[model samples]
Target: MTRIALATASADLEARFRAATGGAFLPLPPAPLPSNPAHLFAQLDGAPAPDVVVLDAELAVDHALDLATLLDEQCPQIAVVLVAEHGPDLGLAAMRAGVRDILHPQAEIAEIQSVLDRAALAAQALAHTVAPASSDAPPATGRVISVLSPKGGVGKTTVATNLAVGLARTAPNSTVLVDLDAQFGDVATALDLAPEFTLADVVHGSAARDSMVLKTFLTLHETGLHVICGPPSPAAADTITSEDVSQLLQMLSLEFRYVVVDTAPGLSEHTLAALDRTTDHVLLTSMDVPGVRGLRKELDTLAELGMLTPARHVVVNFADKRGGLSVADVEATIGTKVDLRLPVSPATRVATNKGVPLLQSGGRDPVTKQLRRLVERLTIPETVTAQPDPDSRPPRHGRRRGR
Candidate 1:
């Protein structure tokens, strides 16, 4: 059964909930609580978190909206649903704000039951996937390669765009790139594609309401690499919660062979949620003291969050031995060996200015070669032997930092 936390400003919530769910749900508090994220989190802050939180419309809309965003960021495992006076009217905004279901306050009993059933099913599947299973478990079916940086202005979007185009050379239409920088994202600007529909539109539009409806929302690049740009407006970003990211990544993984994500600086809630479902992490940084050190600290946080088990790669962008720091120095600082080092090239800046990716720009420059090599590294199989091979041993405390 699905453990559901019911919150409302209505006093007769229990009586009405029973009539709606027919005593089927395992409601937390065994009664109604204040319809807010803090109160709900206080009640169920420990192990065995509820699968969903059903918010009633009696509470203030702004408060409920804030709670929905907070709950998704703090407890992504638990989905959120809201009962509104005009459920259908809320539509895209409701889903964009991390609501799995928006039901009319007087919604049908069956409709309520169906919504609860979906939450329960998703929770059960995630539980099975996230349980502390054997470390030797086989690799997952799909790979989510996330490009992140602890500081801004590190060429993260540049690397992400180039890598996607490089991978598309081998995978054709099977490669996709996603821009997760909600506040200030330049993937669309870099690629020079005027996408009338962006990630925010997908999240707030009817297309994102279902996983199977993947079309027109993603702008197709000339290299056959699909692109999912960030929100056109900063205000639209507030509506996209972490859970929405998880669902989008899951669906994208199903549709594409390679799901390349370019995230904002540092670990935002949306990035962390995507990391949980990711298979490969491309941590990007510049060859500067603050930039590399900040990435090192972010690595520690990811370790504490049990994110080191996946394939982790450190990419040092704008490398110049004569400038600031060398490749070896970067590796020593980040505590992880540099997997790819991109040289500072004027071609990269020109490509970005012209709305074209480095690889697709068709320049036989050093940056283009490195971009191809990056994809080649990703294509290699990660096979392990039963015994240690000193010659090719993996990085120490790098793959499984927390363990």
Candidate 2:
């Protein structure tokens, strides 16, 4: 059973969480607030880390950002859910400080359940993905790649789907695409496949393991590709646990050569779990200043949590030569090199409108070719191989290699 730590000062909030999630997992332990915010981190130091940490925004904002930072640093894998009353700035601050998901106190029980479910899944995924590292295990069989963005509308889904299709075309019998954005998944829409089933079905079903349930929910494209679409409805999103996603990816790694997960935009519980599950993470961004700034903040937060591995790749989608900011400007601003640049095409709209991916539409689109190249670079055997001595490496690599 998954364990959660609720750090809210409000008795009503705690009661609501307990009442809503009581049947889902083990009874939650009483959350005793430390004498001060500093003691909160100390309290977590020696405890058997909780799967999820739910904090009151009142506590977080009143306290320094250091508290959130400490939680992120001390319990890097823990999902930090922030419960707030109102105010957009509070949400922004929590997000900037690396809180996983934000929830209003007035949120419905279903929303709370969804958050708990997502936290559980993320924790399970991290555990499953890192379990092999406890032993002197060999390298993973397949390449696990994650597509992420700090803010939405950066074409993450489009790039992820096209990359999966490209990898399948370049190296058939070795590519699988997973949609991790359970709340707002667009992978199926992009691929134009009305899958009879979804990831939620696989999770809610009695399937023993990810591999056993994979074929049941995954739809095969005419291009010889495979895709595990997200939950059919937003309401079903929370039913999928991080463990389910992690197990699903673990099974896919054994079956396919390449696994590409289209993550939700932002470092939500779902996206964090996806990042923990994959060997490589690709940050997708557009040319907008706010988007670029958000990307930088995300990269920094990931670095702080030791989630930004050396294998992390940054891809600028909808890149245009005529854009206001050049690729150089974006790289300079983000303090990270842009590995891949996909040109903006009017055909993107046409393809999406027709419910088809650009790569499958028989269009000689530059963006399609660029996404394909990115996949090729990621799936290379040399790139997929695990490091020999992980301890001497950086924290991100150690986390990814499970050292």
Candidate 3:
């Protein structure tokens, strides 16, 4: 249960807060905020320490901020929210003092409830990250395959969704696809899912620290695949950090048999964090000159960074004889063999528009055939472990290849 303590003088505000929390708050003295977390806890009168402390900043703004800073240092798990007139100057000060959010004095009950919910989540995440490990044994992880491209409109999302669905078919309830594009991901639309929670929601709070809680956040697809879609909007992407991405993937890899990632076109920090945990990479590119050249540069960059995984599958999408590009030409440009070729097909576009993967619909279209082949490459245990080329040097960071 979420514990809340309110320190406000206004009786009207207290009544609204009671309405919002169903009369479940512990009310403290109205004025003169406590000097520290210990003093504040003593005011609880032997009750459990609150998860959230709502301070009325209308009277003693400086004292509220100082108390917030003390709580941040001493009781970091407690999220501090200030009730004050919202302003740019106050907002900056509150943030500096470790305030989770600043609410207006006249907030409605519904708004109060929303802010409390967010504060509780923030508290949970703070506690989890600051907590130490319980065991010394290394965690057992599953295979993580990341599908990426250097340019947009290269069909990486389509490939990623289809691959994840196909894997789920082979191993029900053991696969998850994460749309790490952050800003403009469309995995939810491709799967026709209305997710109650998203990547932004799962990467923090109790969901981030507990595997069972995290599982509840995933949207269940009809194909039996679990999915963590991107943030609800572009602005939400800013709140998710690279460390959050890394931790989220590590937790997921421990539970799922296969964790498939669909990243943005370029290598953002989030993408790099995902790549750090990826065991296999499905490098995709279109048949055009720009796509091919970009793929070459991406390969060089990955190689330099020592992030090129041993089990890499280079895919050429939109392959056509009339496009003035051949598989051999692509191989020559990238200095790597093309492991898969998906021919251009109108049915593929129609399936995407209809929010159904060709593989999920059991279509016999040419794209579906290639998608099945790609799935086989990942599902078969032997295929997942590729023999490293003798000529290439080992990874720079000495990161192990297999689990």
Candidate 4:
């Protein structure tokens, strides 16, 4: 049966709709419709999303159209119909917003039934076109690799970009890099990309709901690596929520083989949200006393929260023989094995300045070679015997001190 939902305040219209659907339609709150599709879905209260949504234009035509437009983009499978007094202007606007049909305010039960039947058919066609044929095979879930650091200037972005590019080379068009460093992120600049859209765009609109729409928002790199750059400005970052980051990462994991995330310095809420979905952690830090100590604290915190993954890797960047801090010192300080150490090289700075990754340049430099090793380490899968249940984990505390 075709499921229907309605948003209206008119008793007359509600009665007619109930009769038309034979009490089968779900009625939403009368006024102040939700701002977006997500908010609307939240009102379902655990029920499945309806196949058709009917909006009454009497309360607010503009709000109805806006909601219709979002539904058109985010949930294309749901057919939208508007109830309004028919006019040339309203008809044109409704059509532009992809409303399936327009019904008059005094529509009778039979008329409403006829419109609903057509809308249901349209929705069925869309659902079939969007989804593939059913099979016994399980749905594919991609690997989510999040590169994190306790402080800035530890070559985190450099490693993330290189790893993503390397993976893309190995599996072309199968990798995506997401810069979760929202405020002051430089992933776009590192790749010399002038993005038409950024992370902010991907999390807020149709991109957040549809994998195909999300892919269109990503900025593609020359190495066949797709990227979701950070907000264009710090102010723009404020609009994104931790929930947005969580949803974005979940969607990417379903679409790509490797979802490489570049997080900000320290564990911000956004970074923590990414970690919740992460399968591996590339814990990076610089070769210095303070940096190493900070990394220790970060590791301790993650462990306490039960967020550490079995595939965790500790990477020490800017290794120097004369720095007096050996790899042993780092491993001892962080209480973890040093999985990889990248030597300091002038080539790294040059590549960053030119918006190119060392891996993309195919350099034979030691830094480049170490980065390749890190990528190889990731390629070797680690068996996940178990995952700590997030709900059972300890509550977070004092996480705001560092950020």
For residues 327-385, what per-residue lDDT tens digits would candidate 1 score against the true structure?
88877777667777888899988998998887886878998888887887777766211
Model 2 residue runs over 4 Å out of place are 1-140, 208-210, 381-393, 397-403
Clashing pairs in 4: none
Candidate 2 vs. true structure, TM-score:
0.60
- TM-scores of all candidate predictions against the true structure: 0.61, 0.60, 0.66, 0.67
lDDT at 351, model 2: 79
How many residue pairs collide in each prediction? Answer: 0, 4, 0, 0
For candidate 3, write residues 142-171 as lDDT tens digits.
Answer: 998999899999999999999999999998
Candidate 1 global TM-score: 0.61
lDDT of 1 at 324: 64
Q: What is the model-wide C-alpha lDDT for candidate 3?
A: 0.87
lDDT of residue 174 for candidate 2:
75
Cα lDDT for residue 256, model 4?
91
Off by over 4 Å in 1: 1-140, 382-403
